[model samples]
Target chain A: MFEYPALFAVAAVVREGSFERAAHVLNITPSAVSQRIRLLEERIGAVLIVRGQPCTPTEEGRKICRHVERVAMLEQELRAVMPSLGGEEALESRITLPIATNADSLATWFLDAAMGAAKRQGFLLDLSVEDQDHTATGLRRGEVLAAVTTLEKPIPGCDSTPLGSLRYRATASPEFLERYFADGVNARTLAQAPGIVFGKKDTLQYQWVRRAVGHDVAFPTHWLPSTHGYVEVSLGGMGWGMNPALLVGSLLEKGALVELIPGLCVDVPLFWQARRLSSALLDELSGAVVKAARASLLWTGAGR
Target chain B: MFEYPALFAVAAVVREGSFERAAHVLNITPSAVSQRIRLLEERIGAVLIVRGQPCTPTEEGRKICRHVERVAMLEQELRAVMPSLGGEEALESRITLPIATNADSLATWFLDAAMGAAKRQGFLLDLSVEDQDHTATGLRRGEVLAAVTTLEKPIPGCDSTPLGSLRYRATASPEFLERYFADGVNARTLAQAPGIVFGKKDTLQYQWVRRAVGHDVAFPTHWLPSTHGYVEVSLGGMGWGMNPALLVGSLLEKGALVELIPGLCVDVPLFWQARRLSSALLDELSGAVVKAARASLLWTGAGR
Candidate 1:
């Protein structure tokens, strides 16, 4: 606590937006919160928070807030394994590990891995949903402990393990395909057809185009960023997209969504990236994630 | 096309995951795609895609892909304004504008902004839901044309205008409040009480702690990450959270969610940040956004 005591105050001020309010939360007088901030600023040689309508953190202060979050997470982590550590002082062990994952994975298989890990080794899972292409950013910022990413290479100071590939196939409602692709898939038709995309960061639809039409072409796109929304929109005949293999199951069986291009699928190989820590919980997480991915995702590469 | 002709090819190869598939889509020989890629690499002086089990793009390649996407978007914008630019080449005028918005805003008032903009001027709203604390990242990356962000300062090469503040109050299901705060909300109780959070980035719950207990404390929290989910989770009695004013409407009336603190509310100031470009479409968008915010958001500061 001494190592990062000021950080809690700084975080409180940033979160609460004022010293007085932070004091209220800490059960101290506003002056005490101010004194602690003053002492902390003097110690750190930087003004941590701007006293404004809603207080904001300086760049340095933000770094401290992030550090505080990390340390608090670790402290809970420590108490989780070593119960005697915070025993009487802490009534119950509550450790939340925030992990970044893709929307597709969340709808399909990510939770199974999370639940498996939680059941075997108890820890609350706080999932932060970001596109697979960008989930690594959260990991880099220490905003998340682990991530499901498409990047093959490991982030610096992190361990990367292959976690199989999330399979996607070009799909749309039969009515949509019948109307739009009546003349067959081509650059001109693709350029005019409405397409469903995950978001700006999503490249799967474009990849589908390259595989189906053999060129990169832009079309009128409908961005249904959520996994379920993407599927629902595709089924509603709004547009077509590359949907996760598992999510299309019931729809495919019911013939609600027709595969635009059969046998031609895109494979986005995923990897579990985590800090190279000698923590049993992380090790358990890695195993659970790998197991789930292997069971669900396509085997394009060796997942070890 | 000449500036980045081969870029389209490179993007195709990356998307298709192989030169052969890209060639197939293009109705050309695989060798042709390979040759174009080689020439493009020579021109850029950087290797773009790594040929692999499933091909992937390098950092330089990703930048090129992003550039292609931006160019495509701008092209659509251009064709929208000057229909004769493409003349008979293109017909349907469906342009999707990617915009980043905080979840609370997205659920409460941002859609009206989007709808107002869309109705007056035709365009598709590709809304990317990010927390208010971090929406600026999307703006900086050019992933979104505009964003509803908390930062008062504008990103470089972007214009910033205050859009008013989103007011939120600490709320929980009556049962949750009764169970957790029955003994009174002190640091001890807060540390053990279950909490609901939007994501790791969400600090409103902590702000509530600062307001209620007068200090910084951590609680066992469930992360829902979506706007509706945040309310649903809080109402489900999983825990307590600070909810946006309008989102808790009927639930508040019905006592589904009870305010933990009676009048104390946090006002998160928002700003509309967009590229400093002279485009009528952008102007229309700005007007609609400001209009919507004014009608819904609190006038904490002089908007101008």
Candidate 2:
């Protein structure tokens, strides 16, 4: 049988990213934390933690950390049913739910759901931000409990629910449109104009271009990774980029920003995927996320 | 002699993160791109690119990529002087400068400098956001040409210029302060009250708390990784956090947010670090960054 105490130590180390910080959180000595990890490693016959300036978990450690997190969630649920099991200290011990999400969602609508979950359940959140297309990798690696992703299908041992599409417009300032697309936005013009990309992982601009022009076009790009920076740079006529509709609504109305191609939008469908664990807290979080997403995102054929 | 074309191919593959994408950017066939990479690897006697969904550079590959980037900058300068050497196509070829910076700096002051550099020199910026304390890692690894960092000392081959301090105040909504610190602000109260942290790597809140309380205190934290989210959450009465003065100045003046302790502020001194390359473009970028930082950040006792 696995040692629950040692498992907790492993989880704390990974979460805090250091033995000393984990010790402080666990209310134990650093040496004691090291000994517990050593004992756990001997039993498992593998090096779980890679000690460094900020310690990191190996693949084996990540699996163990995931197990401990689920166990903690279950324990919290049990204590809720029987208050006499642990008392006030147990209630005050906050559980952190590590989740992965895209930056645009966090900037627009995800925080309301997160704040609601935290207030309702007294849960702390450890959010990992990644590109929407790549957020599923965290779930696959057992690094995050839940994720906002672009994958319609669920990974094995996980549940997937459809969150509506986040609409994006190929937006540019009036000056930018006039300066670059004066001759019109075709393959020739696009190849010469500068575009804004979120990062190397982001393909939103490429995807939108392929849809608009019917083929890939090589263009010069300024890679600015901030979501808000995208809007600001576009407004400054730095480059044309795919800006989220929700963020650019007022600008578009004010005529500060214009669509490179009017009436053409990209609707990227998102999903909330979480482990299929029978815990009320996880279900509550999933419910809050789905509710927020449904309220803000566009639903096809059924609603505007 | 080293092959310049093959080196450019290595840099492109790493920048684009896929051989096919590199080929598209270089206007070459995929097989031709592959051939260049293989020949470079054979000559170097080490693996350069790790083939995957998105290709990455090995350690040896990073060194070579850095070399190619510097060469590109120098070549651009040479063509600038001798206009007849390459002419329109050369002037049109936009060179990307990969830079590392903290999110707070990027959100506040860095974008202006980035936009300025891009406009003046026809450069493209590839920005990587990391914690201020850790931004220097990219410079040390030769992954980025420049970085905004908290380290006062320069990295071995880099030049560091003081960019003034980004002052932060421990702030919360009036309701939050009343609810959590009804009696007073001390280690005892701080240990029970929740805090907002940017991420696991963020230690700003901890540093502020240690200064306020005179010792380490264990507290629950909501790890929201967005700079704008920090202000929103603090305004929503979610938790107290170390917020940049620039963001919360109006809120403080309007009585929406209050400092935990009125006069205690943490001043994180920032510096601009870049490779000590003799390129005019690098110098122009540095001048722009230093100018922006001076205009926005605090300069300690000498200025308000």
Candidate 3:
């Protein structure tokens, strides 16, 4: 069995991203932190942490850190059931739960869910933002214990729960409409006009254009990665972009933003996937996510 | 001489992240795009584009792409001076200018500057968000032509202009103060209370705590990566965090958020670093950035 103390040292070094910072967190000397890491690596027969300006973990280190996180979650649950197991230190110790989520869900409802879970469980949240289509890769890589992803199917050793769909509208400002699509939004106009893309990874606008124009139309795009920036730039007549319905509903109603094609929307279904662990904290978080999603996201009968 | 047509194909493939999409943008067949890449590789005797699900570039590929971007900027300037050189097609061809910036600046003032530049030049912006301390790395790597960074000194072949310092205040909601610092915010209380962090890269809270408490206090932190989310979570009483003065000014005035320690602020001086190229567009962008920064950021004369 691995030494729990040395395992925790490995986890802290990775989390803090430096041996000195890890020592500060662990309340040990820097040399002691180094010795613990060296001992852990020797026992495992592999190098774990790569020393750098900000230390990074090797593949073996990541796996060990993931194991440490799982153990920490289980310990939290145990302390909850038996308060005497840990007294003041238990109350003060906040386990960090690293989870992956997309920008749209985070901008709209993910925080409310996260806040609720953090308050109830008294834990710190470490959120990693990624495209919804790719969030599951973090789970597969053991980088994140839970993720809000578009994958309906769960990764092995993980439980997937439907979190409903986030709807998007291809929105543009009044001035943008007049300038680019004065005649109408056709394939030719779209091919000529500039659009807004989140990044290279984002294909929302491309997919929407294909659906609206009945074919793939390659348009010039301004890549702004921020979810809120998408709305701001669109409103400022920078470019038409796929803005979430939850975000642009009021703007659309106020005539600040108009859909490129009225009534044409894309509903991207999201799922909450968490490692299958017998931890009450994870269950509580999953419940909060489902509750928040139900309150904010659209749930068509066929979504499930 | 290297063919401009094949060079453009290389830039488009790198920008679009795929040969097929590059073909769409270049208005050519995918086979032709493949042939251009193959020919370029043969001439250079080095692999340019790596064929993948979403294509990536080798080191040589990146260097070539940077050259193409500079050439495009020069061409745009040329077209501007002699309007008769190109007609309708020139007006529609919007070049993508990749720039790096910190998230706080983007949320507060960077987009306004970007909008002005984009509107005047009719170019698309591809923004890469990094920490202020690390934004220069992108510029150094040839990944971005310009950056809003904290580096006061210019890179080897770049121009660095002072953009003023963005002031930050360590803030928390009233409830958070009462709950966490009921006794008083000393080193002991600080070590126990949870804080909010942008991510592992953020050290604002740590710096502030060390300055205030007179020692390094390893406090628990909730890592929420979004700039807007930071304010929302702080307002929601999740944790105390360092918030930009521009974003939390009204909140502080309205008593929605309170500083942990009054009269103590961290001023992160920002500089605009762009490649020293003889292009009118780069000069115009530099002017816009400087103007916006002067208008929004705090300029205590010593910032220069």
Candidate 4:
């Protein structure tokens, strides 16, 4: 069997981005850290790291880090099942699992899933928030083991599970509508009004406009790039934009935001895509995420 | 001369990601929008777009869009110089220029540059906040017209100019340093103490540790992924981490943060990398950015 200690050392170095820092985190001398990494690299017959200002892992190193992360999760599950076999290291060890997800989910319900998983598996999660359409790119590059994405399809060696949909409605503060869109929702008028967007890649507002007006229209946009900020900006009368139904529940009731198009809604279906790791901890993490997604998202029988 | 109206329509459709939206923005019919795109495509003898849920520009289409944006900017600059020649459309037209930049610059001083350029050039800015080290990838991919990056090396066919450097220091609340490092800054103790990090790709903490301790060491980190949140977390004594000198002026004066390693500072050099656009407005934008960067960042004479 591969040396678990050295493998964990490699994983730590990759995560921490420095040999000294990784050594410190592992509570080993820098020399010991170097020796462990060298041992692993020698055994694997590959240069694992490109030592620079802040060292970066090689492609081979990334593969090993991903494998070690999975193994650590499996070990955690194994220890959970067979507590009698647990040693001092297993009792207090916390593996780092880097994950990629969209900004909207992270702002909504994904944190609950992550906290639940952390509590249950005793692993620290490193979440990298990107756009929903692109999170799977991280999974493909082995930068992240799992991602919550819009793609219903699976990667080469991954599993994709349906995780409900986030339903959004075009909304604006009443004052914003009265000021900018006084002429009503038409092609000419949409061009004059501003809309808040999450990022350059956000197409929710455009898609809503296409559906609502029966034609695509170009308009000015305020790129907030934050879920919370986007909502606030829209509600603060800076712009009119799509807000998730789950998040706008209270605001809708309080009449803080007026739905511009009552029947027009955009449904963004989400999926939990993960590298097909045999670890029960991954299964547990997926379970927690699915549970949380269901709790907040509109249930539309998976694979949308 | 070469159907500026049709070309602008194509660019708008690409930006808005829909034909209907482009049509609305242009104050034209959807059929007219489609016709303009078809006319442009037919003239160029190429497929300009891949019509999907969110229509994307094809390779040739991207080139045309980029050219049109540049031409629009040039026209705006021209109108500025010769206001008597400006048409009604020229008076109100706003070109969109997408740029990639690091989060630190965005939070610190880049917005002022963007606002200055926008106010002068009549352009809407789409800023994609990424890490400085990787912003060049966006430049290479033609995803952005320009990027503020750490790489002094110019991307092929792009202009790279020195934009000064951000100075960072290892800092934390005085109470935190005392509590965590009562014995001293050692690997064993650092592993147990939490540190706030901006993102997974952020290596400021690791770099600081390497410089201060003179060895690579691993440590626990809390990835906040927000410039503002990371600072607040550090100030609240949640964790110790590197804070930019420009950002922590007030905090340093108030003794909210104590330098963990005195005289240990990391200066990350930055470059403004941009496609060699022939537009006068792009030149103006770069001048504004360089001026702003000089005002904030420590100048290292270029080519570092």
Report lDDT (CA) for all predictions: 0.74, 0.87, 0.88, 0.78
iRMSD for every model: 6.9, 1.9, 1.8, 4.6
For B1-304, candidate 4 gives per-residue lDDT tens digits of 6788888888878877678767766778889999988988888899988896468888888887877777777777787779797663621366667888887787677766765676555466666778778888778878788999999888998999998889988888898889898888876677667676876568777788777777755565656676655576577676787888888878988999888867689999999988887777677788899899999999867445
Per-residue error at A256 for model 2, in Å?
Answer: 1.3
Give the chain B TM-score achieved by candidate 4: 0.85
Residue-level lDDT of model 1, residues B46-104, one tens digit each, is 99888873577887887776566556556767877797787222322344566788878
Highest DockQ: give the candidate number.
Answer: 3
Error of 2 at B287 (Å): 0.6
**Which regions in candidate 1 have their CA more than 4 angstroms from the true location?**
A1-3, A7-96, A112-127, A284-288, A299-304, B1-122, B130-191, B199-224, B227-304
Query: Model 4, range A140-259, lDDT digits (tens) per residue?
Result: 888888999998889888999898889888999899889877888897788777777776568888789888788766677656565665576667676788888887878988999988
lDDT of 2 by residue, B1-304 (tens): 6787788889889888788778888888989999999988988799999998678999998998999888878878888889687733422367888999999998889898878888889888888899998999999998999999998788999998999999999999999999999988998788777798997778888788889888777687788888998898899888899999987899999999999999799999999999999878889999999999999998763532
Can you list each candidate's DockQ?
Answer: 0.17, 0.63, 0.67, 0.16
Residue A104 displacement in candidate 4 (angstroms): 2.1
**Candidate 1 Cα deviation (angstroms), residue B70:** 16
TM-score of the A chain in candidate 2?
A: 0.96
Worst lDDT window (10 residues) for model 4 chain A? A87-96
Error of 2 at B52 (Å): 1.8
